[model samples]
Target: MSIILFIILLLFLIGQQVFFEVFQILCYTDFRLIRNEESEMAFDGIVVANLAYELKEKLINGRISKIAQPETDELLLTVKSASGQYRLLISADASLPLLYLTDTNKPSPMTAPNFCMLLRKHISGGRIVDIYQPGLERIIHFKIEHLDELGDLCRKELIIEIMGKHSNIIFCSEDGKIIDSIKHVSAQMSSVREVLPGRDYFVPDTMSKADPLTVSFEEFSSHLTRKPMPVSKAIYTSFTGISPVTAEEICSLAEMDSSIAAKEYSEDLLLHLYTQFSIYLSAVKEHTFTPVIYFNGSEPKEFAALPLSHFSNYMPKEFSSISQVLETYYATRNQLTRIRQKSADLRHVVQTALERNRKKYDLQLRQLKDTESRDKYKVYGELINTYGYNVAPGEKKLEALNYYTNEIVSIPLDPVRTPQENAQRYFAKYNKQKRTFEALTVLCKETAEEISYLESVQTALDIALTENDLAEIKEELTNSGYIRRRYTKKKVKIKNKPLHYISSDGFHIYVGKNNLQNDQLTFHFAVGNDWWFHAKQAPGSHVIVRTNGAELPDTTFEEAARLAAYYSSMRGSDKVEIDYVEKKQVKKPGGGKPGFVVYYTNYSMVIDSNISQIRLCAD
Candidate 1:
C-alpha cells in the first residue's frame, strides 16, 4: 500500500512538470494567453490593438443577444454570426480572461454577481460596432450603438483600462457621463478617473516608447541601442504592448539570444536584426503559425510559460504598447485560472489524506515494536525443542550450545503453533498504541484508488459534450458511495455477479470473494454434489465446482486450487496451500466475516496463481 502511494505521488509530480513546460511554450508563442490580460494591456498596449483587429471584424454590429458570467473574472457574449451563432468572451479581468460557448445557459440569481450586473446594464443589447486600442497603451475601447430607454439611437463607449494595478472597464454615454465601471476607483486610489457617477471620462496618457509596427531598421536600432539593455529587454521595455514573453518569442524567431546586450551589436548585425524583426512582425500580422506555449515544473520549482503572475515577473520592465500586453495577459490568465479552479478540490483532498495517513503510519510504526520483540518466542520454542524439559523454565537468557572451546549456538526458531494466537497478542500490543491503524490502512488503499479514479474521471468530465456523459460520472460516483443518493427507491434484493469459470474438464466453477457472495455461490448457485476449495490454514474465498454426474479429474482439482490462490492476498506468491472437499462438508460459521467456513476431511495442495490458462465462463 505504501508502494502504491509513492507511485501515485510520483505520477502527480510528473504531470505537473509536463503541464508547466507546455504552458511556457504556449506563453512564448504569439498565443494571446499571458498571465494577466489587464496588466498586460496596461504594460503592452500595442499588442492589444492588434488583437482587437482580429475580434472587431467578427463582432461589429453583432447584437448583444446573450450574456453570462462563467467565472468571477470573466464574461461570455453570444452574438449572431454569419458563419453561425458565435460566442465572444471578453476577459478584461486582471486574473483571468475567459470566454466560451455553452448550449445551456447558467442560472442568474435575482441580482447578478457584481461583474455580471455591470456588464448587463452597460452593454446588454448594444451593437458592438468597433474595437480599438491606442498604440501599445494598455487600454481597449469598444464602440457600441444601442437604443436608450427613450428609444433614441445613442453611442456608448466601454473603455477597458488594462493598466497595471488600475485595470477596469468604464462605461460612458456619448457625452462621457460615467455609466458604471466593472471595478470602482476613487480619487483616493489614483489621479486617474474615479469612475464614479457623473464623472467625466477620457483616455489615459501613454507612458512608454514608440510603436514597433511602424518603425524602420535605423530608427528601431537607434531607439533600442539607446536603452543600453539586452535585446529582449530593449524590445519589451521600449514597446508599450510587447510583453517579455513576446519579446523573447521575437528573439527566438530571429534566431538570437534575447538576453544579448543591444550595445554589443554592430551596424551590420543591427540591420540584420531589424530586418528579421520586420519579417516576424509581418508574420504575426498575417497570423502565420500561431504558437501554443506550455508551462512545466522542474524538480525544485514549477515553470510557467508566462510568470504565474504574468505582469509582475514575466513581463518586461518596459514595453512598446500596453495594449499588446493586455491581450496576452487575458489569454494566459484565463488558461491558468481554469486549470487551477478545476483541480483545486481534488488536490486539497489528496493532500489532506496524505497528511493524515502519514500520522497514522507513525502510530503503526510504534505499535509494531512490541510485535518485533515477541518474534523471539520462536527462538524460545527452538531451544525447548532441542534441549527439551532439561532447560530451566521461563528462561530469557540465550545460552551457548555445544562445547565452549569450539562452538556456541543459539538456534533459529521456526514455530508451528497456531498463528492466530501470536497475531492476536501482537495486535493487542499494536492496539495499545493506536486503535486506528487498521482503519488507516483501509482508508489509505481506498484513497489511493479513489484519487487515481478521479483523475481519470476529471478528464472524462471535461470532455462531456453532452448531458448524458456528465450524468454517467455523477451516477457512477453516487452509486459507488462517493455521494449520498438523492432519489427515493424501493428496496430490491441485490444480486452479485457470479465468478463462474469452466475447469479443464468442462465442469463449471465459481469463486466468491465475500460472505454474501460465498452464500450465493455455494448454496444458491452451486449444487450440493459440487466440489469446494479454500485455503487450508488462512481465510480465503469459497470456490465451488459443478460436476453434473461426471467423474472428477485431477487436473480440474489443480485448477480449482489455483483459483483459491489467485483470490487470496498471496495472489502473486509462488505457492499457496489450499484445502479441497465435497461441497457437503463445508458449513458457514454462525458469526464470522462473510466467507468464513468450517469444513471436515479436506485434501491439501500447494498451487500458484496462474489460473487464467484455465478457461472461464461467466454463465
Candidate 2:
C-alpha cells in the first residue's frame, strides 16, 4: 500500500509541473493581432481597457488608505490590498492625461486642495468593490463602498474620462447624480456637456461612433466603406474605441495599405481587415494583453498593451504589467519635459553669452586679420630707411624691390611729410598694429574659452535630472560670474552629487554632471591610480573609474570611454574621440576655470556613445 501511494504522489507532481508549463506558455505567447508603423504614446481606449483589466486584478477589494493631490490636475491614491500596498496616480491635465501605478511619492501643498479634501472625506476608508472600463471608451469607473457620516453603508462611483482637453474626474452617487468634479465645466464652457456640480452626468455623443465590441462584420464594412477618407481614418472615426494607430494596425495585419481610401479597397480586402480587427477585439475580451514599448534607438517611440508587429524592425521592450509600462514611459517622458522647461532659462543665458562671445571673437578675428598688414608696414619702414635719400620731394609713391617675395612693389607715400618723416611714421604705425594684434589674440582666446565653458554648462543642464541638480548648475553659473548671485540671509545647501555606475567588471565609475562636480571629482574624490576620461576636445562630463589597487580590465576602460562620450556635447555623433589618463596625470592650471584640466600624456580611443549595458548605481 505504501509503494502504491508513493507512485501516485509522483504522478501528481508530474501532472502539476506540466500544467504550470502550459500556463506559462499561454501567458507569454505573442498574438500578432495588430501591426502599425504609425505609433503614439497617448493612452487610448484599448490601452485604458488593458489598464482597467490589470487594475481590477490588483486593486479590487483594496481599501483606500490615503488621498492626496500633488498637482492641481493630479491625484495620488494610496490603496492597501491583501497582497501589498499600491499607489494609483491619475492626472487630467489638458496637455497630458495619464493614469498609472507608482512607488514614488510627490510632495503636496501644506493644505490639501478642495478636491482632495472632498475625496478624502468621502472615500477615506472606502472599500473598492469594482474597477472597470465602461464600453470600449477612454473612461474608467471605480465603485466604492463606504460608511456615510450617519454610519450607514453607501456607494459612490468615481468616473475618469480621458478626452484630451475635455478630460475630468467626476464624483457621483451610485444612481448617477453628479456630486462634484476636479474641474467644473459649465454650459458656457462646453456646449456638449456641463461637468458642473448638481448636473446629470452623461457621456456626450459627440463622435457618434459605433461600439467596437458589439459591432457586426456587416456593420463594420458598411460604416468604413461609406466614408471616402483613408482606411485608417475611417476605422477610427467610425468606431468609439479604435485609435488611428489601432486602425492602421488592423490594415497592416490584413496586408492592406492604411493610407488608401476606404472605398478603394476590394471587398475581399475589407473582409480581411474586419477579420483582423475582430481578432484583436477577441484578445481584449479574453483579457490576454502583452504590454510592449517600441523604441526608436534608445528613446521610447510608442507603447501599447498589445503586441506591436509593425515595429518589428525597431527594438521592442516587453513588460509584464501594463501599469509598469505606463509608469516608466510617462515618468521618463515627464522628466524630459520638466528638464527642458526648467532648463529654458539656463539655456537662454548660455546661448546669449555664447552668441555674444562668438560675435566678439569674429570681430576680433577680423581686426586681427586687418593687423596682418602690419608686417608690410614694418617692411616698408625698413625699405624707406634704406632709400630715403633717393626719394623726390613731391613723389606720391615710392617703388622698391620686393625682397620678401622677389617681386617689385609700390608703397604709397604722404607727400606732405619728409622722406625721413615718412619712414618714422610707417615705423610708428607698425608698432601700434603689432600691439593691437597681440592684445586681440589674447582676447580672442579668452572669448573662445568662455564659449567652451558655457557649452559645458549647457551639457550639464541637459544631464541634470532633478531640481537639486539644477541648483548645483545654477550655483556654478553664479560662481563663474555668468549669473549674478542674489543676496540672501542663508545660503542654500548643496545636495546634488555625481552619477555613479558599475561597470561589467565590478569597477566603480563616476560621472560629473556639472563643472563644479567635475573639478571636485577629479581633484578630491578620485585617487592617484584611478582612470580619468573625457571626450577629446569637446564639452562633456569627466568620467573617473576607481582602480582600487587592481589591474584595470580592457572592458572597464572601454565602458568608461563610452560613458565619457555619451555625456558629452557630441552625444548624437556616431563616434567620438576620448582621452583617458591616470587621475594623477590630470592637472588643473593655476587660476584656471572650473573643469579646465591640462594633461600632457593620455591614451586615446574612438568609440560610439552607447552605454546602455552599464548599470547605474544609486549613491
Candidate 3:
C-alpha cells in the first residue's frame, strides 16, 4: 500500500510539470501574438499582474522586519527572505499610485502616523505566506500569517488597489471584514462604495467588465460589437484587465485603426484582434514578462512590464526584474514631482522678479529713446554760440547759417532775455538731457542683468533633484535679495554639491545646479588647465571637465557640451550652440552678478542636448 501511494504522488507531480510545459508551449507557439505598439506608464491591471508575479517570487515566506509610513499615502515594508533583504514600497497616492521593491530609505515624521502605528501593532512581525492577484484585476493581495494574543496562528489579508483616485490599501481579517484602510471612502466621497471599518470588504463592480483571462472569443466579439465607441475604447471597456494602451496594441496587431468605431471593423478583423488579444493573455498567464523602460532621448518616456513596440522609434532599456524597471521609472519621476512641488514658491519669486525687471528694462529703453533728441539740443546750442553776436535785442527768433549742416536754421528765443542768456538756456537744457541719457543707459544695463539672473535661477530650479539642492537654491535667492532671509541664531550651511559625471574617455565632468555652484565649480574646484563649457547666450549650468594636465578627448568635449545644453534654458531646443574654453580664459567681471563670466576667445559647437549616453557618477 505504501509503494502504491509513492507511485501515485510521483505521477501527480509529473502531471503538474507536464501541464505547465504544455501551457508555455501553447503561449510561445501562437504567431498572432505580435508585439503591441503602445507607450504608457500607468500601472494598469496587466502591469499589476507582472508586479504581483515578481513580488510572489521575491517576497513569499519573507519575514516582515520593519514597517514605516513615510507619507500619508505611502508605506514602506522591509522584509528578509532567503535571497536577501528587500524594501517593498507601496503607495496609494491619487496622482501616482505605485508598488515596487527598492533599497533607498525615506525619512519619516518624528511621530508615527495613526495608520502606521495600527499596522505595527497588528502585523509588524508577521510572515508573508502568499502574494497573489485575483482575476487579472488591478489589485494585489498579501496574505500574512502571525501569532494572536492567544499564541494561535491568525491569517490577515492586505489588499492594494491601483485605481487612480480610487486607489486604496485595505487591511482585513480572514473573514473579509475591513479593519482599516489608508484612505477612508465615505458615501459622500464615493457613491459607488463606502470604505470604513467593520464594513464587508468588496471590490465595486461598477464597470461590469468581463474577466480577460477567462473570456471566450464569442463573448469578446459580442461585447465589442455592442459598443458603438472607438475600437480601443470598446476593448478596454469590455475587458476587466485591458487598459487603453493594451487595447490600442490589440488594434495595432490587427492592422486596424484604434480611432475607428468597433462597428466599422469587419468580422474577420474582429476575429484577428481577438486572436491577438488571446496570445497576449496567454503570455501573461505563462508569466513571460519583459520589463522595459522607453526613453525619448535622455528623458524617460514610458515604462511597461511587457515589450512596447509603439516606442520602437525611441530607445528601449530592458531590466531583468519588473521591480527594477518600476524603481528607475518612479525614482526619476518622483524626483521631478517633488522638486516641482518644493520649488513652486521659489519659481514664483523668480518669475515675479523677472517680470518686474523686464518691465523696468522696457521703460528704461523707452526713456532712453526720449533722450535721442538730446543730440539735437546740443546741435542747437552750438549754432547759438556760433551765431549769437548778430542777434538783435528782444529777437524772438534767430536765422543763421548752420555751419555743421551748411543749412539755414531757426532758433526760438525768449523775448525778455538777452541773446547770450538764450544761448545759456539752450546749453542748460542740452547738459540736462545728456546726463539723463547717461544715467538711463547704466540703469538699462542693470535691469537687463537682473532679468538674466532671475532666468538663470529658474533654470537652476528646473535641474534641481533633491531637497538639499533646493536649499542651496533658496540660499542663492536669499543672497541675491530675491527672497528675504529670516533671522536665525545660526548660519545655515549649504550641503548641496555639483552633479558629477564621468565621460566615456574617463574625464571627470561637473555640472552646477545653480549660480553659487556654478561659481564654485568654475572658480575653486577647477584648475586653470581644465576645460569649461556653457550654452551660448543662454542661461544654463557651467560644465567643467577636469583635464589633469592631459589632452581631453573629443568625446569628452562633446559630452560636456551636451550637459551644458541640457541643463540650460534652451533644453528643449533641437540644437544648442555651446561655447567651450579653457578655464584660464574665463574671467569674472568686476561687480558682475553671480555666474556671470566673460570669455573673449572660445571654441563653439552646436550639439543636440541628448545626454542619455553619458554616465553619472556619485559625488
Candidate 4:
C-alpha cells in the first residue's frame, strides 16, 4: 500500500483506542500534500514548551502595535518592545497550524476580518503580561493587560491552539469566558467542544494521557500495554506531549524497535524505554533544545526542539531560536505551495492550447504532404496537351515523350471526355493542389509558432519562483488569447522584473521569466553591445549579459548559458545546445510571438543546466 493510505489506515485503527484530537497530528489530509513522505516535522507539546520560553523572554512587556488577518485563520501581530520590533505569525489552520517569528509579512484585506476587528478593539495596544504553556499540550496562552472601555485595567487571554482542524485562536475573559474565536465549533461541528462567544473556554482533555515527566515507570508500562498497538503509537498515545516521531526517537534511544507491539515488550525492555523517556523529559525541563532542521538531501525532512539522533543520517542544521527553525524549515514549502496554486490555472490554459495547436499542426502537415505532387499534375497536363492530337474518340490513356526530364510519361484519361476537357481537368487538379500547398505551408508555420509560444509559457511557469513572475506569465497568456481578460476599471500594477544574476567573473546577467519579460529584456533593456544567450531550437528564457562597454569574458558567457538552459523546457537534458550572439545581431520579428526573434550569425555551445554556482543579486 502507498504510505499515505498506510498512514490513513493506521490512524483509523488507532482512532478507536485514541481520541481523534490527540492523534490529529497524523490524519490531516492536507499534511500528506505538504510532504512527499510522512513528514517528521511536528508542532507537539515539546515544541509548544520551547516556544513558550522564547515568547516569554522575547514578548513580555511588549505592546501589540498592530494586528491583521491576512488569512481567515491566521494572525500577524507586530510587537514593539525594548528589544526591537518583531512580527509574530500564528496560524490556526487545521491541516497545518503553525506559530513562528518571521521576517516576511502578508498583505491584508482592505476590510479586516471580524475576529481581527474584535481583537483590535479589545487589545490593540495591550502589553503582554505573560506567555505560558499548560503542561505539554499544543496550546499557548498570551495574557495581555490593557485598559477596558471604562479605562480600568483588565487582563484577557489570547489562546492559540495548534490542534489540527480543531486548532483555533480564542479571545477569552480573565475568568475564562470565551469572547470570540477564529473558528466556531458548536455541538453540531464537534460534540467534544463548543468554542463560541458566551461559552466557557477550556482545552479538552479527551485523551486523558499521563504526563511523561511525572508518570512512574510502572504506570507508563501499565497504560502503554492497555492498548494492543505499536510501541511508538502506545508511547505517543499514553503521553500528552509526545508525537509519533518523538516516540520513535525514544524507542531508538532505548535500542528498541518502535514497530514492535507494546504488549510484547518485557519488563527489562519497558525499563529501558522508561529511562530514555526520562532523558527526554529532563531535556525538556532543563530547556536544552538544539533547535535544528534535518535535511534529507537538500529538502527539509524534519525539525525539532531537541537533537534527533535517528535523523543523524540527515544533515542537521542548528538554529539560535526555535522560531528560526520553523521559519527556515517552512520557507521552501511555503514558496512551493504559493507558486503551485498561482500557476495551476495558467498550466491548464497553456496545456489546453498546446494540445489543440499540436493536433492542428499534425493535420496541417498531413494535408501539406497530399499537395506534394502538384508539380506532377502540372506535368501531366502539359504532356496531355502536347500528345492529345493522337487520341481516339474514347481513349483511356495518353502517352507523351520529350518531357523536361526526357522520359516517357503516361497520363490516365476520362474515356468520354474530349482532349480540351481532359486538359482542363488536369489543369484544374494542378491549380487546386498548388493552392492547398501554399495555404497549408503558411498554416503549418502558424500552428508551429503557436505551439512553441505555448511551450515557452509552460517553461516560464515551471521556473517561476514568485507570484510576480506568475502574474507576468498569466498576463502574457491572457493577452495571447489563450485566457480571457477580466475587464476591470483598475489594472493591478505589476512590479515584476527579470531575474538578475552576477556571474562568478562579476558580470551582470539578466534572465527573463516569461515572454513579455523576454521582449522587455531584449529590445528595451539591453543595449546593442550586450550579449544574448538562449537554448538552441527550444522554448526558454532569454538570458542577457550586460557588457558595460568592456570586452566579454568566457566565464560570464557560460554562466549566462547555464541560466538560459536551467530556465528552459530542455532543463532535464544532460547537455543542451545554447545559441549566443551579440545583441546587435538579434532582431525582433515585425509581429511575431512575444519571445520570437531572428538571428542569422550566432555562436553555439553544449552545456549542462547547472546554475548552483551562479549567484543572484540581492536587490
List the global CA lDDT of all models: 0.58, 0.86, 0.86, 0.87
* TM-score-sorted candidate list, best first: 3, 2, 4, 1
The C-alpha stretches of model 3 lying farther than 4 A from their native spots are 1-42, 59-90, 101-130, 143-157, 171-182, 196-202, 207-283, 292-302, 307-320, 324-352, 385-412, 474-496, 523-530, 546-556
Estimated TM-score for each candidate: 0.46, 0.73, 0.74, 0.61
lDDT agreement of model 3 with the native: 0.86
| lDDT string, candidate 2, 406-438, tens digits | 877788899998888888999999999999999
* Candidate 3, run of 10 with poorest lDDT: 31-40
lDDT of 1 at 145: 84
Please state the error at residue 184 of candidate 2 in Å.
3.4
Per-residue CA lDDT of model 3 for 515-552, tens digit only, reads 99999999999999999999999999999999999999
User: What TM-score does candidate 1 get on C-alpha atoms?
Assistant: 0.46
Summarize candidate 1's per-residue lDDT along 1-619 as a digit string, tens digits: 9978975776587787765665554453323334434233233443454455655656677778777766554556687755456665555555433222333345445656776776676568888888777654667677888777788888888776665445566778788888876666666444655667578887655445767778877788877888877998898777556777667766776667777888887888777778766776674455432322222100011111122222221112222322333334444554544544554554454356456656665565565544454434444444444554343433433354543234565533224433333334444544543444455556655554444444434433332223333344455445545556776677433433546678768877787634455666776777767888876655456788889867789999998888787665555677899888888887876643334467768788998866645665534
What is candidate 1's CA lDDT for residue 465? Answer: 26
Please count the clashing residue pairs in each candidate, in the order shown: 68, 0, 1, 1
Residues 1-619, candidate 4, lDDT per residue (tens digit)?
Answer: 6977976886787775564654453444446445423333559899888999998889999999999999988999999988998999998876678898887989999999999999999999999999998888889999999999999999999999987657789999999999999988767556788999999988788999988878999899899888889999999998998998899899989989998898898998898889989988798888777798876423467888988888765567789999998888888667766788878988988888889889989999999999988888888888778889999989898878846999887788999999878988989999999999989999999899899888889999987888998888888888888778999999999998888888988999999989999999999999999999999999999999999999888898888998888789887577999999999999998889999999999999999886756776766
Pairs of residues clashing in candidate 2: none
